[model samples]
Target: MNQSMFIVWRESVEALLVIGILQAWISQQSQSHRLSKFLWSGVLLGLLLSGLLALLIMFAGDAMSGALNEWFQAGMALIASLLMVQMVGWMHRHGRSLKQDLQRHADQHLARRGGLGLMLLALLAVSREGSETVVFLYGAGARLRGPELGLFAVGGLLGLVLSALTIVLLHSSRRFISWRRFFALSEAVLLMLGAALLVSASERIGGQLLAMNLPEWVYGSVGDALWDSSHWLNDSHGIGGFLAGFAGYRATPSALTLAVWLGYWLLIAGWLRQRREEPLPCLG
Candidate 1:
């Protein structure tokens, strides 16, 4: 449930940011109301795309039912995790410029295609996020069900509505949430979620490799339990469970899981530290 909530919250927040950027730009333009219509159209079309992607993934998963399917699923999980990490990194590096880029694109479209160009710009922007959300949610949902899934969906809906209201408030009164601060806060949480997904992917792959008749020592090395934290704080209840869902906390994680998780954080943290130390771009 926690995992689902975080996934929805993080993803919904991102989607809202995109919409907010477009909406803000439109407000400054000569034809602001047209922008709203284009925005809604893009949103509806993107949703349709998301639904189709979800169906395709389900059909594909159903087709692969044995060891091969497990391997495929594991591979997909790793891909999704890596994509998430890349996404968060990109957002950190470019979040400030994102609005400018969108506005520039919108202007270019207006010059070349008039009103139709606005629709295209909105469609492309929303559809990219929509497709990604569908894929990531499908992969994550595979790990949860029943009450947990319900909670996750609810959390996502809440995030979506809250974000939308925030935009409305900010636009109307200029007295609501500051997006820069919000992104800064959410970025760390999103990164942690990415790490959890990576760990889960690695473990799933290890299990598949073992079942495929790989040598006992090889699989054993990958699966060897590093430590058990279930006694101290179980992962199915309270704070531990939330951490487990959001950050891939395992009671008895394998040596590989521990190694990969540690390595990922070290690399990301070091890169960010380096970026911080670097001089700002010269304006001359």
Candidate 2:
């Protein structure tokens, strides 16, 4: 429920940011009255498309029940992790140019394609975030059941409400809160959540591989019990469970899982390092 809430809040906040920027730009125009109609239409259409995607995910999950579902789930987890990584990176890359880019897009559509183009722009922006939210929620909550699922839905609703409030604050007065700091915190949390998904994916794969009766060496090397910290910190209950849910904190991790976990962080760090060293492209 916590992860679901966070995912919804983060994704909704991002969508709101884009919509807010476009709406604000439109408001500044001399003839924005008609454009407002297009903008609202686009947002509604985007939301409709997003609802379609959610239904698709639901139906697909319902269709697959056994091994196929496991594989599908594993794939979704990996995809979610990759998406989270890319999302944070994308925000960083476009953060500086986002406002300018949005305005330019609005100008292009308004001049060339009129209302339809602007509508399309808004549609794509909102739909992208909306679809991402669906996938993230699905990936995070695939294993949950019963009343927990109810709480998951509740969390999402709360997140939406919170994001609405947040957008208002950002648009009006953000003196008490810094957007940069907020995103920095988000990036950190996302990385941890992404790692958790990766770990879950690894477990799925390992379970399948074990079932296949593969070479003993592979299991010995990868599946060998690394340590037993369950006594000190049980991953199935209490604080350990929360960490496990948030950051893939396994109390008794196998060697392979540990390697995969460590490797994920190292690779992400290297990517960030390389990205920092690369020269920025000239937008002029």
Candidate 3:
């Protein structure tokens, strides 16, 4: 439930930011009334695209059975996880320039070609954010059902409402909340969520592998837990459960699960190092 809420909250803030940027630009223009309709239209269309994606994912999940379903879910989670990393990394590296870029695009579109250009710009921005939300939610939705599903829905709506409020507050008083730190924290939380999803994908994939009647050693490595800590820190209830949901905690994790979880961080560290070493375009 918390995972769903966080996912929705983070994604909502991002989507709202894009809409806010476009709307703010439109407000500054002379013929604001004319362009407002197109901006709203683009938003609705982007939302529709997201809705269709959600429906497609749900139907596709229902259509599959047995190992196929497991594999498909695993694939979706893995893709979502990768995309999360890309999203966070991209923002971390470019958040400083995002406002400028958006404003420049708005200027270009408003200057050269008018309504249609703005509409398309809005469409692409909203659609990109919406698509990311869909992927993130779908990955989280894999484990939810019944009343929990209701909570997920409620959580999503709440996230949207709360994120809008947050945006308003942040924009109204940027000094109170350091924008850089806010983004840095958001990115950190998002990366943690991504790692959780990666671990989850590994779980699903491991289940499929075990179902294939692999060798004894493979089964042992994938199925047998290194240690049991449920007695001390139960992962199904209390604070531990919350942490588990947030960070892919397990009372007794298999060797493969542990390896994958640890390996993901190592891989990310290496990638960050590589990115830092690369030369950047000269400002001069």
Candidate 4:
């Protein structure tokens, strides 16, 4: 539930950020009211696009059965994990210039195509964020059902509310929490969620592999638990369960799971380091 909440919160915040940028630009235009209508229309269309995607995913999942279903879910989880990493990296590189870039594009669009171009711009931006949110939520909550699914839905709704409040707070006062700090903190959490999704994918794949006639060592590495920690912190309940869902915690992890978890963090660390060391572009 927390995973769903966070996913929705983060994605909603990003979508809102894009809309706010476009709206702010439009507010300063000569035909502000005219453009505002197009902008809002675009936003509505983008949301409809995202809703269609969600329905497609749900129907596709329901259509599949047995191993194929597992494979599909695993693939979705893997894709979501990769996208999360990519989003963080892209934001790390482009966040400082995002507002300027949006306004510049808005200017060009309005110049070339008037309100139509502005509408298209807003549509693409909102759809990108909304589509991502749908995929991420599906990956995170694919297995949820009954009460759990209800909670997940509630979490998403609460997240949406929180995001609105968050934007208001940020716009109202930077003294409390700046955008930079918010992004930095959220990036870390996103990476952790990515790890969780990656682990989930690996586990699903491992289950499929285990069912096959694999070599003995392969089974040992993928299926055999190295040690038991459930006595201390059972991953199936309470705080540990939340950690398992949010951060990929394991009470009795197999070698394959451990290897994947470690490799993910190592890659993330190296990527972040390289990004940090890259020289900033020189201004004229």
Instruction: Residues 109-142, candidate 4: write the lDDT tens digits.
Output: 9999999999999999989999999999989998
| TM-score top scorer | 4
Q: Candidate 2 — what's its lDDT?
A: 0.86
lDDT of 1 by residue, 10-112 (tens): 6765677677777877888888897689877877787787778878888888898877677767767777777777776677666767777777988898889
lDDT, residue 200, candidate 3: 91
Looking at model 2, residue 81 earns an lDDT score of 91
Instruction: Flag regions of model 1 displaced more than 4 Å.
Output: 27-35, 166-177, 278-284
Candidate lDDT scores, in order, read 0.73, 0.86, 0.82, 0.91
Q: Which portions of model 4 miss their true places by more than 4 Å?
A: 277-284
Better of 2 and 4 by TM-score: 4
Quote the positional error of residue 104 for candidate 4 in Å. 0.3
| Residue 33 shift from truth in candidate 3, angstroms | 1.6
Higher lDDT: candidate 3 or 4? 4
Q: What's the C-alpha lDDT at position 58 in model 4?
A: 91
**lDDT-best of 2 and 4:** 4
For candidate 4, give the lDDT of residue 233.
95
